[model samples]
Structures are given as C-alpha cells and as structure tokens.
Target: MEQLLLNVVTLVTFDGAVNWTVGFLTTVAIFAILALALNIQWSVGILNFGVAAFFMVGAYVSAVLTLPAPEGLESYVAGWGLPIPVGWLFAMVAGAVLAILLGIPTLRLRDDFLAIATIGVAAILRSIANSVEGLVNRSRGLNGVDGFLEDQVQGGDYRWVELAIALVVLLAVYWLVSRATASPWGRTLRAIRDNEDTAKASGKNTVKFRMGAFMLGAMLMGLAGAIYAHRSGTISPLTFSDLLGTFFVWTMLIVGGSGNHRGALLGAVVVGFFWFGTPLIQESLPDWLGSRVFQVRQLLIGLLIVVFLLWRPQGLLAERDRVSRFVTRGPDDRTRGGDQGSVWERLRSAVSR
Candidate 1:
C-alpha cells in the first residue's frame, strides 16, 4: 500500500526524457484534434453533447479495419486485416458518416434539445457496441492491432513512430483548421452561430453549412481515434467514454476558450497535462491520503469547471474575433462590420459607444 503511493519518477535520463517527451506531445496532438472537433461544433453554436460517439466510432472502426480476426479466444469480431493507413482513412469517413446520419434529423433541434439528442445518440452507440458482438467484439475489445507498424518501423518500440506521426498530423490539421476558420466559410459558420435566422435570410444555406461543419469535425475526431488506436495498439468501446473522452474534451475546449483554434490547442495541452499528471500527483500525496487522492483531483477538476462557468466563462484566452484589427486602419476608420476598437481600446470606447 505504501509503495503504491510513491511519487512518479521524472524523466531525468535522456532516454526516459525522450520517451516522456514523445508521449506528452502525442497526448497534446490527440486532444488537439478532439478539442478542435468540439470547437467546430461549439463555435457554430451547435451543442454537441455526444462527442464520445464520434471518437468511439473512429477508434473502433480503425481497430476493426486493421486488426486480424481473432482465434478461439475471441469471438464475433470484425477484422478486415487492412493496412493501418486504410483504417485511418475509413475511420474518419465512418465518423463523418455517423455524424451525417445523426445530424440529419437532430440538427433541426435547437440548443439543449440538440445536446440531449446527441448524448442519446452516444448512449445508443455504446449500447450497440456492448450488445453487438460482430460490431466490436463486445466487451473483450479488438486486440493484436499493430501489424502495420511491425512491418514498417520494425524497431525497439512503436512509441517513437507514433509520436512522429502524431506531431506531423497535428501540424497538418492545425494549419487546415486555422485556414478554414479564417476563410469566408468560417465567417459564415460564425454568422450562423451568432444568428442562424440572419444567416439564412442572407441566403446562406445554414443547414448545409451546419451539416458540413458537423461532418468535418467528426472526421477530425475519427482521425484522432485512428491515431490513438495505432499508438495504443488496441481499442474498446470503453475508450470513448462520457466522463473521460466526451466531457473531458468538452471541458478542455471550454477552459481553453472556444471559437479560437489556438485556444483549443492550448486547452488540449493544459487538460492533457492535468489528466496525465493526476496519477503522479496522487502517488505523491501523503501515505494516508494517496488512495483517495484521485477523488481529490476529480473534485478539483469539477470545481474548476464550476468556477469557469460562473466567472471566467470566456476562459484564459477570450475568443479573438473581438479584435480583427488591421494595423493600418485607424480607430476613426470604424470598419463597417462591427467592433473596431482593437480589443484593448474597447474599454475606452465603450463609454462613448
């Protein structure tokens, strides 16, 4: 019992440092994908409470696609034994398809109702994963899913391979999402988010835009799951859980500041740190409290959520749309769109405006 409470050793040595660094970066990458997915929905004023479903679909789909069929020990598992890359592609498609199917009817619902409907969809998927043996091998989960890496890297461990892939993927996705949010398309989504009726009135196909954004975000979630499965070498329905996957990702996005890509990425990093750090923190706690230290951490996390909701709702970084200032444009220019006080000067101008 006392030994269980030992502090987590830091990655002091070079080898250990490399491993930890890779693992940390991989964590950041995966959560960045998930948080960005959530941000896509939230920034568009779409309340997606079932983020776990898309994540679960992606992981399971990739695992099923890539894994070899189980022998006597396992039963009713769907294993195509395809290449991992194929699995990743299909996983993303699967997530997008799932989102489309779910979003078709559910998107019509507004706000809380849509949120509830989405969560219900997540619950439905979980139930199916548990009940349908052919779907995901039921509770046993699909295993032996690393044939691609074994063939490609053929090395000491696949962690480095995964880290490299994750970093590259993170950078690529970050650039794409950033470009997307800065484009006219992103502006349209924001317009719909702020006022769907106005956007529709202005001839924007609000429904199509919402559906497209939903699909795109789900694809990212799916991609995250695929990479995660490749990294972890296995996946189960339990992997995309409400508490850990869905709610946790949501918390990160909210805490990081939604509607901003940087905020979403930063949120992912911070939340990921706290998440992985919790076990170490618990182990480091005094002997008497170490066992229950996890509960304390949970308490702290909940308290943070509550405090942020009540007070700092905008989070550590406020959404940057408030200040789309051109360096050349003077304050007197007053761009026709709206709010041209360079954010900092907003307070000064507020009294007069």
Candidate 2:
C-alpha cells in the first residue's frame, strides 16, 4: 500500500495536475461561450447549422489580422500583426456580417430548409478554406498565432494566466447575455420563439426579431473562435469540423437545456468532462478498447443525448418562468417561500391591463 501510494504521488506531480486542470477549464470556458451563443439563436427558434463555418471565419480572420507578416514560402495573405483585442473585435463583426448575409436570403425559409442551407454554407466554407491556397495557408493552416498577453506572462504560470483571462471573458459574455435576455427585447424574442403567431398578432415583427437574435448569437460564436485561436496558437480547416464545432456544441445545449443561460454553462462543463476525459483513462483499458476509446466516448455521448431527450427533454435545467418586472412585492416578500399566488395574480392583472 505504501509503495502504491508513493508511485501514484510520483507519477502525478502537482504542476502537471494544475496545468491539466487549467487547460480543461479553459476549454470549458470556450464551450460555455459557444453554448450561450447557441442558446440565443435557439431562443429565437432559428435552426442554425453553419456554426462551424462562423467559427472558422472568426479563427481565420483573427489569425490574419494579428499574425506577423509572412516570410518566404508562406502562401497566406495579410499578417498585419495587430493587437489581440483588434482580432477579437473584428472576428465578432465578421460573424454578424456573415449572419446578415446568410440570414437575409434564408431567414424567411422554413426551419428544415434553413438548416439545409446552413449545412451547405459550412461545406462551402470548408471547401474554400481547403482550396484557397493563397489565403488562410490552405490545409497547412496559420501557425504561431499570438496568445493573449503572451509577452507579459511566461513559463508554467502562463497557463494559469490564460485560464483566468478565458474565465473573465466567459463571465463578461455571460453578464451581457444574461442582461440582454432578461429585458423586454429578450421577452419579445422568447414570445416569438414560443408562439410566433401570437407575437405577430401582438404587433411584433417576428422576422426582424429573429434576425437580430441570429446576428447576436453569431457574433458571440465569433468571439469564441477568436479566443480559441489565440489560446491554441494555431488553426486550420480541420480545426473547424462539423462534429467538433457544431455537433458537440449542440449536444451541450440540448443536455444542459435550451432557453436557459445557466443551463448552457452547466451543459458545457458536463460535456467538456466526457469529451476531454476519455483520453486520460484510455491507457487503463485493454489495448483494443483503448484504441477505440474515442468511438466509445462518442457512443456514450449519443446515448446520453437519447436518454435526456426521451426522459428529461427539458434538460438538466429547464427554462425559468418569466415574470413581469412591474409586479410589486409585499413587505414580507423576502421571508415568503415564494409568493406564487400573488405573482400569478400580478401577471394576470398586468395582462388584463
């Protein structure tokens, strides 16, 4: 027993454990941002399938904007070597612009049709990135992309610094998203999502509201991509695969529960565990099983999705009930368990008015 304990302690150094943890949390932060962005789109009832494409655009745009000038034999264009924040800002702009261009033509289509169009868009983007040798460095991808504050931080400590920065970005995005979603504009969006006909009858322009939501969601997705690129320090067409970029994110949202921002964050952390955990335990399994561990991990994820959909479709966290902000509270409101009756009465009274 003493020998086994000593061996385990020697194998798992404190620094190694901390670095691994930081890397894992950073990935979760990225996923949380993506999930939140997707939640916005889902709230507006848009079935966007081109999320990977938007992510690729943001990565490449940020890479190009911030990269140093290419040397001999480098085929990619535009390495302006700008600051990282500039890259992040323009990545968002590119995403929103792409959304507008795509949304304008296809937003009016039915959900299924829109989904197909978006899939095609992702494929087209992938093909362009692959074939355009003069731009984005073709399949070779852009390398040596700058890290956030790399100049200021060095050595093993940089991982912790980057993780902190990633968390800060995640929190900022969460704050902005949560604030936006709780406002009247957000309520209108939810109203449109839940019942478009009723929202239309209420004199809301459903199409415009949907377009706005889509743009906002895409912008956040772009920001996520930028953060990912800077963190990883390299990117390629392969990095933006539909499976990794699209499917996994959708799974996170579905599992966490759609329409709830907190659910989105929870789902990201949960999915990130399985997605990143498989490799760690692979060595402990039989050789054949270890070799196919990724397949097993994917199968497990599929099973989880099926289970959640059939039994708990609302997800681990269901969307919260929305109450009117104008509802007044009694003096004992803080002590009350929850004034369900009065809350409903206020809602009814407000609706009647």
Candidate 3:
C-alpha cells in the first residue's frame, strides 16, 4: 500500500504530468464558479434549471466581443479593441442582462415547467449560435481571441502562470461568494428558495430578490466563461453544448452539497479529477480493456449519480438546517376563518387562536 501510494505521488510530481495536473486544476476552478452560480439559482432561489443558457450566453458573448476582426469584416464589426479584462467585464454584464430577460418570463412558473422552459432556451441559443454566421461565424466558432497568457510568456513554463492566475481568480471568487452567502441579500435568496410566498409575506420582494440572484449567478458564470475562452485561446459554439457541460456542473453542485459554496468548490475538484483523470489511466491499460474503458467511465459516472440520489440526495456537504418555512395544510385543516387571512396572517392567527 505504501509503495503504491508513493508511485501515485511520484507520477503526480513528474514534470511531464504537471501540465495535465494544471489543466485539471484549471477545469476545477472554472467549474467551481459554475457550480456556485447554479447553487445560487437551485440551492438559494430554488430554481432548478436555466444555468445552461446563462453559461452559453456568457461564452458566446465573450467570444464574439473579444474575437479579432476577421479578414473582410474590419470595416463592419471591428473587434472591440478592449483589453481582456474589459472584455471579461462585458461578458459578465451581457450575461446579467440576458438573465433578466430570460428570468422574467419563466420565474413565475413552477419547478418542472421552469426547467423545461430553460432547457428550451438553451437549445434555442445554441441553434442561433450555429446559424448566425455574421455574429458567431456559424459554428466555425470565434477564433484568435486574445488569450489570457498570449504573447506574454515562452513555451512550457507559461502554464504555471496560467495556473497561478486561475488560483487567484478562484480565491477571489471564493471570498466573494462566502461573503455574499452571509449577507442580507443572500439570506433573502435562501428564504425564497425555501418558500417564495413565505418570503414575500415577510416583506421581501420576491421578484426583485429572484432577479438579483439570477443576475448575480449569471455574472459568475460569465466570469467562468471568460476564463474558459482565454484558457483555450479559442472559443467555439460547440463548447457550450447542453449535455456534458451543463450536466457536469449540476453534478458537481449536487455532489458537493448544493447550498454550501465550499461544497461546490470541493465537488468541482473531486468530480473534475474523475472526469478527466480516468481517461489518462485508461490510455495506459492493456489492449483488451483500454479501448472500451472510456465508455465504461461514463457509465460509472451515471451510476454514481443514481446511487447518490438514492442514498444521499442532499449530497456530501448537505445543508445542515432546513431553511424553508412554508407549510402545506390539507383542506380538512383549513378553517373558514383562516381562509380570510394572508399566509402570514393565518400563521399569526393560528399561533394566537
């Protein structure tokens, strides 16, 4: 056992392996941001879906705005000519704006209906990205965008710099999310998640709160998109496909503990390792099993999700407290006098009666 552990550690420490490790860490940091965004919606606002649309919008907007002018288009949509940081800001703002537009129509719907609506929105966005030639280059994707590390460093060693920057961004986001989840605004979001009507009765403006959470979550997703675009040094519409990207983010959030930011981050790191690392190991296996193991890895992931739902739906770092206070009473228990009162008023009267 000791020798096996030593071999694993040695492999991780090797110079050739460092780049892959850094790439994995970068993926974890990016998805950690995405998980946190979904947590704001699903865990804090009780909105289960729509993260995919926000994520796609962020990626597309950032890629388009920052992409260098194509050969003939210099006269038309000449690139914004802004620095990468400015481009990132634009990406985040665009995401927030789109979120408001998307949220207004669907926020009033119940859980499953909202999910379906949001999924439709994501599909529509992808289709538009694929079809809009002038805008996104029609599935060819946006290329030649200024990379975060472009022209700034030599080969081989530059990944370290990228890794360092990613770490800084991750830490900054971690601090911001930690503070936000403890703020009054965050508490209101949690209240809405637990029971929207109850939150409104307590004088919280539910619509306003929901919009705020949606926008904030969208902004974080946009930041993640910006990092992703720059990290790859290229952006493609296909990168935002609804399957693995969206499901992986959801899986990370679920595995980490939905309402907890720390859990979200940890879940991203844990799942990301398995998501990418297993394939590397499979590549080295004997010929008989190595070829088919990639398929098996995906099957294992699906099975894991099913098992988790069955045994620990709350997830690894489940929220310690029940944050919602809405009560459901049967018709037999609803007295005529209580029917005349608002939800809050009825609760008060029930206590006093």
lDDT of 3 by residue, 57-98 (tens): 776666666666666642214366567777688779977997
Report, for every candidate in turn, its global Cα lDDT versus the true structure.
0.76, 0.82, 0.70
Backbone Cα, N, C clashes tallied per candidate: 0, 0, 0
Output the worst ten-in-a-row residue range by lDDT, candidate 3.
1-10
Give the runs in model 3 whose Cα sits over 4 Å from its true position: 1-13, 72-78, 284-289, 322-353
Ranking by lDDT: 2, 1, 3
- Candidate 1 per-residue lDDT, tens place, 1-353, comes to 01211235655466765666667777778878889888987878888888888888888888887777767767655676888889999989999999888888878776687788878888888888888766677877776667345666756576667777888888888888888878889899999998889999999998899888888899998988888777777666776678777888888887777787776887788777786666656656788788887677667777767877787676655564443536444344443224343543542343244
TM-score of 1: 0.86
Give the better candidate number (1 or 3) by TM-score: 1
Q: Please give me the total number of clashing residue pairs in predicted model 3.
A: 0
Cα lDDT tens digits for candidate 2, 35-89: 9999999998999877898887888899899999988777788899999999999
TM-score to native of every candidate shown? 0.86, 0.88, 0.82
User: What does candidate 1 score in Cα RMSD to the true structure?
Assistant: 5.3
Model 1, position 17, has a per-residue lDDT of 57
